[model samples]
Target: MRVLMRQSAFALILSGLATPGALAAGSHLVSSQKLDWETATKLASEAVRICAAQGYSVTAAVVDPSGHQQAVVKGDTVPLQSLSVSYRKAYTAFSYGQAFDKNTTSELINAKLAGPENGALNTIPEVLFVPGGVTLRKADHRVIGGLGVSGAPGGDKDEACAKDAVAELQGEFQ
Candidate 1:
């Protein structure tokens, strides 16, 4: 069958690639960490729920390590702008956190990039240098992604919701 032929061909390619130095002479495979959709959904929903419990309608977003949005949840009554802002915040936290070798919040990233020389980082479209953004990590401290919340009156308040959400789901990545 055509399907079996394709499978056999794929297996052959994989076996070849598995041999040492079989790939592109000097290049090698790269491994990355990421959150499954179910986990990302749980994280985003929990963030929004925590904020809603506080009488704040907010949006929460989770992004993969590569800065791709994994899941997003918007609390009832949250403004439309909160949606995109949430994603941007998550991207900023993940990207900057990886660069600094630490799980970071937007507040921490902002402070680290405060100097005049680093101001240009702000111009990056996906960079939102504010609180309410924090990197998500596994039990071994490997960052898998980020979470962000917005529309909670202040960035600090948003951050609290984000952190509480992570704490609530601590066992997820373990």
Candidate 2:
């Protein structure tokens, strides 16, 4: 009877009918990759440099997958508001998986795809439905974080700086 019960339980576990830890003496292992501080800072710095080269004083921010600020680089002449805007843009990109391609998050939001009525995404706090934000993907195409650049006179210019920064560090992504 005991042998039959054990076999049944084992089968249940194998079939995923039982809870994961029901028959396990140890914990399950989980692994995920995240952007390191060094890489985040490098990205921010590169974005700022790119914007400066284009004669745009901007603030660049990098955020993790959890929408936490990883690094922020503010140009000497950038306004204080740019800091918040840059952070919001980064958070939005990280939350929405938006890339800095031809059509940015801002454009889509403005086009009503993610308008205020659509889950009120535009009304979300700390989310800037604007361009200048780009998702950071690993070589395996896993999104690890996001970068945002603000105060570049236009969203397109800011997006360009952010895109250039990510392109420059393409090889460094794991």
Candidate 3:
């Protein structure tokens, strides 16, 4: 047992020396942008407002790239399930945005993943393949989060609200 431990320790030391760059502080640190609370809140509110103007009550949710909710807004009398569905839609948008280069809901809805070949994706608790979701991106086009709107008359209406919200606040997304 002692021999194995010593050999493992020696191997680790030799590997560290062989790759000196791995020991550098910069190599251990990574930097990435995340969606801020203010921006997320603005997105959710704007989506709901846009849908309201079209005579539809809706719930909007914003989620980080990892599918965690950042903010949510629900209009009066929207179905209680709308909250969860909105968040899931946002999560699905972000997830597929990572899988595909494009983050727009139109691209996602048209993707071939709906077939049985990838239909298992729906089994995941946080993913909803519906069309109300859009990605939030940095200026360089890196997706930082997603926005989803639910409870509109149809998925298309919900998608329009989400896209309109993003188009309005894109300046702040960075």
Best by TM-score: 3
Residue 87 C-alpha lDDT in model 1: 88
Model 3 has an lDDT value of: 0.79
Error of model 2, residue 63, in angstroms: 0.4
| Ten-residue stretch with the least lDDT total in model 2 | 98-107
Candidate 2 segments whose C-alpha is farther than 4 A from its true place: 1-30, 98-112, 117-119
Q: What is the C-alpha lDDT of each candidate?
A: 0.78, 0.78, 0.79
Candidate 2 to truth, TM: 0.76
Which digits, one per residue and each the tens of the lDDT, describe model 2 over residues 26-123? 43432345678999999999999999998999999998866789999999999889999999888877766633332345555666555455577667
In candidate 1, list every pair of residues with a backbone clash: none
TM-score of each: 0.78, 0.76, 0.81
Mark the 10 consecutive residues where model 1 has the least summed lDDT: 15-24
* Stretches of candidate 3 exceeding 4 Å from the true structure: 1-25, 115-118
Which tens-of-lDDT digit does each residue in 97-133 have in candidate 3? 7667657666776875543666687887787788898
Q: lDDT: which candidate is best? A: 3
Identify the runs in model 1 with alpha carbons over 4 angstroms from their true place.
1-27, 106-110, 114-118
lDDT for 123 in candidate 3 is 83
Report RMSD (Å) for each prediction in the order shown. 8.7, 8.6, 7.7
**For model 2, what is the error of residue 69's alpha carbon versus the real structure, in angstroms, after optimal superposition?**
0.1
